[model samples]
Target: AILNSCEYGEGWATDTYEKALKDDAEYLTTEQQAMIKAQHALLKADHDKVKSMHDTLAEIA
Candidate 1:
């Protein structure tokens, strides 16, 4: 609750960064939205690869 209620002072993480950090955002900063989407895609790909490897190892075991 403290983080959510924090005031936006500057672009610094210790300030407004908490509020800037949101979820399921369709438009984040407008400029960084595309980059954020790309980052999410990379995360999903990495997660899928890890999951697949785990499943394969489980089957082997």
Candidate 2:
């Protein structure tokens, strides 16, 4: 962004003057998103299992 500033103008990095025209967006690629989706289910299930165990212990106490 700094390198392109001269051609684009200063504050260009922060400029939302024309929001739809502003093109600097960042995100995971399709392949990265797919991998995360597969792993996320396992992670969420593990978290839910631990949470359930914690709740059971809390109830017993």
After superposition, the stretches of candidate 2 with alpha carbons farther than 4 Å from their true spots are: 1-26
lDDT of 1: 0.47
* TM-score of every prediction relative to native: 0.54, 0.53
Model 1 misplacement above 4 A: 1-27
Candidate 1 residue 27 Cα shift, in angstroms, is 7.2
Task: List, residue by residue over 41-60, the lDDT tens digit for candidate 1.
Answer: 56555555655665676689
Clashing pairs in 2: none
Please report the TM-score between candidate 1 and the true structure. Answer: 0.54
lDDT of 2: 0.46
Q: How displaced is residue 34 in candidate 1, in Å?
A: 0.8
